[model samples]
Target: MQRTDVNTLGEFGLIDHLTENFVNKQQTTILGVGDDAAIIAGGDEQIVISTDMLVEGIHFDFTYTPLKHLGYKAVVVNLSDIAAMNARPEQITVSIALSNRFSVEALDELYAGIAAACKTYGVDLVGGDTTSSNKGLIISITAIGRAPAGRITRRSGAKVGDLICITGNLGAAYLGLQLLEREKAVFKDNPEMQPKMGEHAPYLLQRQLRPEARTDMVDTFAKEGIVPTSMIDISDGLASEIFHICKASGVGAIIEESGVPIHNDAQLQALEFNLDPITTALSGGEDYELLFTIDPKDTEKIRFLPDLYIAGEIVAKEDGVKLHTKGGNIHPIKAQGWNHFGE
Candidate 1:
């Protein structure tokens, strides 16, 4: 008998391998896997469901990550997936496994954050499970959203000549993580030393600890009468999400280096850390921005969209996924983004 390692398949591959044999038999099951969220038919509307798990140490560190922010973020990340499907997230179920280390007051603080997120997003907590764990805290949230049959978007709908667009700036959350790790290391070395996060700490830390889903974009799309040909939220990175869209849609993409949105603060921080700003934007994960492709005819519709960047265009698969560099260079874009199995 041979023993197989999970790392060899990677996260997505492992999922594919495990679920490859299963078949969806229900008529309501419109989508089952290989997408930001699963879709179910519901008469005139489609229900979008997405679940995410966050484990301590792996996804976050307690030294810097507040319990409240963690609770809020856990929910937001799941909602982002629903938004990627162009749906409205109306409810969520939060299940948690925790050890005896947490006190009642601590749980209160955590729930307070979750409640705040629910209030802010106009969602309901609904129901979930709470159990004891032997190790660290783990949070699993399942977001439930709905959209009209015609408005439900999928990753497989992109076509050649579609305009690739992105919401908000990239790389700031990654930089914020880097900054927190630096401070954590410094604090570990000198117990008396305070963390030096600098003046830009607020924005960077907020981006990292409490990223907002692009749910507003769904409303914008409704208002503007524009439907994306394809869409995916950027949880991994810009490059990796582009690869996902390309693979799903059977199309290639040409990303313009100059068009990728990078914040000034992130640029400064990247330079301070001896890293390329563009590389950070391309490969640094956890930004939670929306990456979508729209029909070329819809270009004028997104022109006045706040914080939207026309970063690239969909192309024939034969062209291959490549990046047009600012230095007049063309290079095949690699998915050097977050690897869940990599240590």
Candidate 2:
């Protein structure tokens, strides 16, 4: 038997290679593989579909992450991708690959979270597949959303001079994971210690166990009569997401390092962990906040919003993406997206 290293083809290359060979037989597949969600033609509106796969151990640790919270997190992540497209999620198909180690009651608890998220988001579960797996549990969720004609946002729509806006705080989720892993290690060595997690209680834990998607922001933007020139969720951190918007939009950006938001607890935790809060905000994944570029005029409308921040302004292609540091140093903002494939 021959084994090929998956790393031989980088993430993008692999996606391009696999998707390139397949021809779209259905006209419904309006777009695929390259963006946040695959666009499908639909009646009176465009349908957006996004799928996310989470593998136990690789994507999460069942020991610390409860089954119910994991279930909700999985759906939220997928829905976050849909929200990145400024689409309203209407339905979902959840597929699970599980081992016999999980009890029927355990599965019930997982679905309870899923059911809760569905009700909270107003999405219906249409269909899915359940299969056996020899390894850890695997959950794949495909979320379907809808948007009116010309309302759907894509990564390719950014233009020079567009204002880059990010919703909610950043770095908390990454720091949250760091805190959990550190505590888990401590607990393993001293079982009697009872976990000395003081200030880093709920926020960090909630971030790791149950990060919420900003679908409400999507709805708000729509009501405010503004369409993001381009958008991508901050799942892969601010730096990587900014790069995605830049590359797709064929523009550049100058994001203010100071303007990037970081929660107080996240900041304190990062300091205690000896991690730079800015770096964590830059490269940390799974924040699930929406990072988008809007027309300069729209900036005025949202500038006063509490959670949203005008972190940067898009620049010309030649300028390239960069960050303006606190001391006034301009440095290139590199792509530090999640390297799950280790490219």
Candidate 3:
């Protein structure tokens, strides 16, 4: 028997391997995999469904993370996935597993965040399940959304000459996570000391603890009459996501280092940690921004849209994924983004 190490497969590789045998037989299943969400055929509009899971120690740590924020984040991440499909989120089902360490009050606090997120996004919390767990807290959320015909985008639609783009700034969330982990370590050593995060990086901390989905960007696209050729949310780092688009679309990309978005605070924080800001923006995950591609003709309209930046352009698959550095150097783009499996 060939015993293969899972880490060698990575997250996307493992998923592809596992789902290879499973075929979608139903006519209603318009999409089954290879994208951010599965699209089901609806009468007038397609229904997009996506799910995300957060394990206590792996995805998040509760020591400094508020339960309410965790609940809110759990929903937002799914909503982000839905938005990546260019769908308007409608409803969600949440399931949780926790040990006896939690109380009714704690549950309420967590639900309060979920409720707040639902209210903010105008989605309904339809159903869910709860069970006891010997391990720490676990949250699984499934979000359903709808997209009008011809408006639904997928990772495989990008073509040569399509402009690569991303929404909002990047790298702050990764810095925030680093800062939080550092603070947690400090607290472990000295109980009386508090986390020394100043007002300088409030946005960073918020980006990590309470990320918002880019549903507003979807609205902007609708208003601007722009349907992306290809789309995927920046849940993983930019480089990893770029690789996903290239592989799915059978095209290569030219991402410029100068084009990657990084906020001022994130740059400062990166310097503080002696890390490269570009590296963080490229390899750091969990920013929840939208990375997409559009026809070159739409460049004028894209410029008018707020918070969207054209980061690169699509090329022939044989050309290979390359990054044009600020110093006029070109390097092969590698998927060094978040690997959920392991290094």
Candidate 4:
């Protein structure tokens, strides 16, 4: 048999091929293997299911990425997808593939973080699979959630003139990863040297190791009577995720480059890394924040929102998606984001 490279299939193609013949026997599987999560038909509320996979070299590095945090992150990443759908995650299934290198104690530490997240978010660990792998450790998590049938958000609903908004700040995670990589290099050379994360400790280090999904923001919308016209999580960076929303909604956007939020510590870290903070904010992945749009009329609702910021507004397709530079130049916002395969 001839061996084929998986990258040739691409992520989307692989997903399609793997799920094409898998029929959903239950009527509850109204939507599956597509969209942000599987939308299930239920009584008054709909159930949403999402899964995420993290491989050693691709998703994270075990040398610095402690097993405990890795387990927690694997769970949170999938929940972020659920939150993107404006659903409340209720349960998760954690599956792991391990080699002889890991001991029973290591597994316990990993589950400790998983249990911590479940407790923090009020979710349960329903069930999952465990297997031995010849390579490094792998974690795959599936989150099951719920929301009112009409209240669920999707990627294909933004209308012209809707305001584009995002929660918290962006770019920190990518820069944080860069910092970690630098430290790892330094440590490799001098094992005696302690990691000098310095003042950038709390925000950057926390972002890289223990990122939290914006489920609280989804819950906040309920309290504030706000429903996003379209929604996506900033896992693939703001510029790329904004493209996903625009592409799905058949609309375009104009984001004020100056209006995008960046934290002070994150800015300093970016400067130290000799990176463009704005570019990082635009293209950094794994932020796990929410990017959404709302109607012009409801703009006031989020105007005073403490954690949310209006980055821009949706425009006609002819207007095209763009970013207004500080120099007042309009440039097309290309989705030159992290493509794990290749550009």
Candidate 5:
């Protein structure tokens, strides 16, 4: 037998190679892969389903992350995928595997966050499962949502010349993570020095610890009477999600660095970390903001929308994906998003 290493394929590549042989046999299975969420047939509307897993050491660290925030984030990430489809999340199922190190009180704290997120997002906690694990805590959340007829969006619908748009800001969450790691290292060396983050940068800390999905943006699109040409949520960074849209839609894009939204605090902290803010904005993951494209004809409707940035435009595939810098420089857009398989 020939030995194959999983890291060579990477996360997305491994998924593609593994599931390539699986067949979608049912008429109700509208989509299978290569998109944010799976589309399924409903009586009068389309049902969007998406699942995400957060492992103890891989996705999060208890040394710096609170249980409540972790639980909330686990749900929000999947809901963000639902929002990427331009759908409103309806319910979620949470499954947890924990080791003996956790107490019943710990589980209560986690569920409390899940309940709060459910209320905030206007969804119900339908059902889930529980199990034991020897390693550490693992959470898997599956979100279910519905979209109105002909309203659901996907990565493959973007058209040439479509305006690429993003909601809220980017890179703050990544910066927050960096800050937490630094503090964690300090605490490991000297346990007496506890990590206190709220005093300095509340906004950036919140963006990482407890990020809210852009479900409100889906509402904004509804109120504005605009359907995006295509859509994806920025979980893996702007450049990575852009590649998803371009590859799925068979188009390229050119985004302006000036147009990419970055919060003032995020930029300040990026400098503290000795990093370029724009680089973090492009490569940082877990912002949970939306990255979408709209038809140029309907662009006027969203012009007045708050915090909505028209960052770029979809171009023909031959043009290649590029980025225009604030200093009038153009370069190829590289995918530096989160990779589960470490390089």
Candidate 6:
């Protein structure tokens, strides 16, 4: 038999390859795969379901990540998926697999964070499973949300001439991860040395450690009477998410370099690390901000929305995905975001 490597397909590719043969047997499964969340028919409203898993040493580093923050982040990431569907997350089920290394007090601290997230997001902690693992801790959370029939957005709704928009700033969380890893390496070399994250540490670290979902943006859309033509949360970098939206919607995009939102602190840190701010913003993952497209007719509706950036526009698929750089250069925008299978 021939051997094939999982890394060859990457994460999303591997998912597609594996699930290609599965057929949806239920009519309620409005969406099955290849989206932020699965949509199901539910009487007056649609039910949106999203699940995410975080593995120890892979998704997070305990050296810098607190249990409380980890719990909150685990929940937030899944809820972010729900938000991507332009839905309101109402419940979450958290399942954990941990080794004996964790103590009862540690579990309490972790649940405290989970409780905090539940309270903050107004979601209920429904039911979940717990089991033991020999390797390390693992958390899997499933978030359930609700959306009106016509208002639920998906990745496949973008159309040509639609305005591409993003919520909040990008790249800070990636820089925060870099900062934490750098500090961790320094500590590994010299235990007596303390981390010097400088002035930007708080903001950057907070972004990486405890990211909040843009569920409020869903509310903003409702208040403004703007239903995005398409939406996806920025989990896998702006460029990658753009690719997802484009591929799903059968359209292309033109991103303006100047319109990409990079926090002032993120810009400084990127330069300090000898990285391009725009490139960092493009490729850095885990922003958890929403990337969505709105009909051109609805442009005025989003004009006054807070913290929103009109970064680009939907175009004919033949145009491909290109970035109009501030330097008067236009080039293909590459999807160089997170690849779980990469070494």
Give lDDT per model, in order. Answer: 0.85, 0.81, 0.85, 0.82, 0.84, 0.86
- Candidate 5 has an lDDT of 0.84
Cα lDDT tens digits for candidate 4, 1-343: 3434434455555445433433444334465555655554466788888988888788888768987898788888999999999999876766677766766556666777887777777776655656678998888988888899888999999999999998999998888888888889999999999999769867987887899999998888998899999999999898999899999999999998888888888889888878878888999888899999999999878889798999999999888889998789998999878777632
Which pairs of residues collide in candidate 6? none
In candidate 5, what are the lDDT values of residues 265-314, reduced to their tens digit? 99988887799899998999999999999999997899989989999999
lDDT of 1 at 139: 90
Clashing pairs in 1: none
Q: After superposition, how far is residue 228 of candidate 1 from its true place, in Å?
A: 0.1
Model 2: pairs clashing at backbone N, Cα or C within 3 Å: none
How well is each residue in 80-100 modelled by candidate 6, as lDDT tens digits? Answer: 999999999877767788776
Q: Candidate 5 has which clashing residue pairs, if any?
A: none
Candidate 6, residue 121: lDDT = 86
Candidate 5 residue 6 Cα shift, in angstroms, is 35
Flag the better candidate by lDDT, 2 or 5. 5
Model 6 scores a TM of 0.88
lDDT by residue (12-37, candidate 2, tens digit) is: 55445333433333334466445655
lDDT of 3 by residue, 90-183 (tens): 7777778876676655766788888788888887665566667898899999998888878998999999999999999999999999989888
Clash count (model 1, backbone only): 0
36-63 per-residue lDDT for model 1 (tens digits): 6555557678788899999888998899
Query: Where does model 6 exceed 4 Å of error?
Result: 1-43
> What are the models' TM-scores?
0.87, 0.86, 0.87, 0.87, 0.86, 0.88
Instruction: Pick out the ten consecutive residues of candidate 4 with the lowest summed lDDT.
Output: 18-27
Deviation from native of the Cα of residue 245 in model 4, angstroms? 0.5
Model 3 misplaced regions, further than 4 Å:
1-43
